[model samples]
Each structure stands twice: as C-alpha cells, then as structure tokens.
Target: MPIFEYQCRECKKTFETLVFGNQEVTCPMCKGKNVKKLMSAFSHSSDGKFTSSAGPGCGSCSATSCGPS
Candidate 1:
C-alpha cells in the first residue's frame, strides 16, 4: 500500500491515507467519499544538501517564492 494525499470535495479538507490496490478513499474529517487525489511533492538529499522538487514555498505552501536569497 502507498500513502496518498487527497482533498475532500464535500468538505474541502485535505488528508493523507494509505491506499490499497483500487481501494476507495474517503475523507477522515467529513467521511466524504467524493475526494480528489492531489499531486504530492518530493525531496531528496545529496552530499548532505537537501533539495525540494517543489522549487518554492518549501513544497507545502502556495507561495511563489520562499527560498533563500
């Protein structure tokens, strides 16, 4: 099973859950079955340096720029 992030269409809340093969997802807050899978961001480290695939906003926010100048 893989963990996936989802946004509830009914409650407009976000949550993470482990999904099995073809398993239905539901929102934990509202118990809504109508949910949409979100695109998850990832990061990696090389030579003790951390990098994010999100490019900005630390991969968790919608900010246009949040990196060091």
Candidate 2:
C-alpha cells in the first residue's frame, strides 16, 4: 500500500491514508468524505545522502542566478 495525501474540502484539513482499493477516504478531523488527492513530493535515498543537478526550491531557479553577489 502506498501512502497518499488528501485534503478535506469541508474542514480544509490535510491527512494521509494508505489506499488499498476503492476505499472511501474521510478526513480524520471532520470525517468528511469529500477530499481531494494532492501530488506529494518524494525523494529516495539509500546512503542517507542525495544530490541532484537541481540546486533547490523544486528546480524553480532555471536562470541560475542564485548567489551572494
């Protein structure tokens, strides 16, 4: 089972759930079933350290102008 993030439309609370099949998702705070799934950001690491070509801020710095000049 994969963990997925869901935002409740009624109470605007964010929660996570392990979905196995067509299960009805409800908010843990308000118990509202009307929820929307949000795309989660994830990173995998084996040696506890990971590096990428993208500097930071989710690759938003495409101009490469981040520095202390």
Candidate 3:
C-alpha cells in the first residue's frame, strides 16, 4: 500500500492516508470525506547505482533532483 498526502477541505488540515483499492478516503481531522489529493514529492532508491530523476543533463539543470552518488 502506498501512502498519499491529502488535504481536508472541511477542516483545512493536511493528513496522510494509506490507500488500498477503492477504499474510502477521509480526513483524519474532523472526519471529513471532502478531501483532495496533494501532489507530494517522492523518492525512489536504486540498488547500488547512481540515479537521476531529473532525466538527462542533470548537471546543467538548476534543480537538484539527482540522487546522491
């Protein structure tokens, strides 16, 4: 199960939820069903390899999205 970030429209509180196959999504605070999924940042790990989520020519990019060496 993947954890997703959500914002409650009713209470205006941000929370995390574990989403499982059509399961009901509700806010932890105020128990509000009116929630919106947020585009949260994520990271992935590669086994013993250098990875760059920023795609090619990451050295020239301003953002440092490339994983550590």
Candidate 3 stretches with Cα past 4 Å from truth are 43-69
For model 2 the TM-score comes to: 0.57
| Cα-based lDDT at residue 36, candidate 1 | 94
lDDT for each residue of candidate 1 in 1-69, tens digit (9 for 90 to 100): 387778999989977678999989989998889999987522421332233555656555677687565
Q: Show model 2 residue runs off by greater than 4 Å.
A: 43-69
lDDT of 3 by residue, 1-69 (tens): 487778899989987678998988988879889999887524543342333344544544566555354
The TM-score that candidate 1 achieves is 0.56
Error of 3 at 66 (Å): 32
TM-score of each: 0.56, 0.57, 0.56
Please state the error at residue 11 of candidate 3 in Å. 0.7
Better of 2 and 3 by lDDT: 2
1-69 in candidate 2: lDDT tens per residue? 587888999999987678888988989999889999988524432232323445653344555565334
- Whole-model Cα lDDT of every candidate shown, in order: 0.72, 0.71, 0.70
Clashes of each: 0, 0, 0
As for model 3, its CA RMSD to the true structure in angstroms is 10.8
